[model samples]
Target: MRPLQIGILNVMHDKAATNARFTKVLTHAGRPVALHFYYPKTHYPSGAPAEVAAILAPLDLAAAERMDGFVITGAPIEQLAFADVTYIAEVQALMAALAGRAVPQLYLCWGGMAALDYFYGIEKHLLPHKLFGVYRERRLAPAPLLAGLPDEFYAAHARYAEMDRGQIEADARLHLEATTASGELLLVDRPEANQTFMFAHLEYGREGLLHEYQREVTAHPERQYLRPAHYFTDPQTMSGPQFRWEETQHVFFDRWVDRVWAKREAKEVSA
Candidate 1:
């Protein structure tokens, strides 16, 4: 298979961890991939270094034009209103550029919510309780993203806000691919927009949730953060976390690469 170029926009606080998760699943996707990472102009975590002026900074749209596909990482600022977010405007601008380029994108968690709001006017509502756990998912539409995945499988969902199922169900613009038990949309495919919005963290490693839980507890001990659902082998004993979504994650990435390749070939032939 020919090598594909991917643009990864890191909007999260923990850049290293997110990059590691994506690299592990994508590197072995049965094709050679070259990843171009770009840090957003705003909303870096509290402890991150301040921005330094650069004459040679690679613009987001410039990067988009040179890539076959792009991925927007999940972030921790879901509770804030879209306008209230520090980098909301910057994100909107970048998304506009991606849309202008007609680049295929896979938006994760917070990224997904932001895209939904921007493109479809769909708003994210705060959950009464944090949706912190793994949940079962089933295919809703026959989309390329779910190419070889089973009819039923599990995925990790750790978010404080979610879109109303009614809004998703009513939207004819998207080809709804999968949903969780509670009718939360897990995967949405907007063929018209050429974007895939994912609510779960398929790229999470074996102990990803464990580390996340520990981090939250360490950061805010006064607030009782419930452990992730369906994560560990033994819930009562709080045993070691077991990874159950890697295979599906790999298949999804492979299929995404194939889809991007097909699009490139089609354009070449048409030209």
Candidate 2:
């Protein structure tokens, strides 16, 4: 059997860790998946390391075409508009290339916003509450990408902006899958091409959330009002810290892998 060549377009703010987490989940599924990472552009004036920026500076359409599957992850920084970013043009070009292609893509957080904007021509707006912590999302409907998940599942999320449910409902092409406690759209899928655009971070563990919390505290201590203990109050589980986080990741990974593998099988048979 041929190994699945997964091309990951991971950008700044612990993107390396994000890709590593994702790879760990997919590989643990017992299938062969080769991962290729697209590092972020370095000279980005956004405080990202110059070394990392150099690897992504020359990122182009050619880099995207080499993968069977792709993932565009969240970035640490963003301006009001997509055009404001230094690599926006290149990223736009890359998205345009993927349109109508059979190659599946899973976009999380900012990438989800960008994908929606690219497909439907609408921008995301800042949400009043920065959704910063592990949260639960209830699956509204079943899709190939969410094949094995329960009606409600946990995904790590930390964002200050969001697009309303009305926006997604307005687009006939986008299928809304999951929603938050306040009825916010958390998962959307493009059924025609087997692509998923998730506003929540399903690729995170407790450790990931802890690292994120530290960054937030370091940047704006006032915002430190948000704490893991608030979400994971159970001392028994949350106390171990690292072990609990790893276990959390494993549970979600099992579900994610099953879903991906099923989709891969269906696509191959249909092909």
Work out the TM-score per prediction. 0.91, 0.81
lDDT for each residue of candidate 1 in 199-233, tens digit (9 for 90 to 100): 88888888878878888998899998888988898
> Per-residue CA lDDT of candidate 2, range 195-240, in tens?
6787766677556766776777898977544555335556445544
lDDT of 2 at 245: 29
Using lDDT as the measure, the top candidate is 1
- Model 2 stretches astray by more than 4 angstroms: 40-58, 222-225, 228-230, 234-271
How many clashes (backbone N, Cα, C below 3 Å) per candidate?
Answer: 1, 2
**Against the unseen true structure, what C-alpha lDDT does each candidate score?**
0.79, 0.66
TM-score of 2: 0.81
The CA lDDT at 72 in model 2 is 80
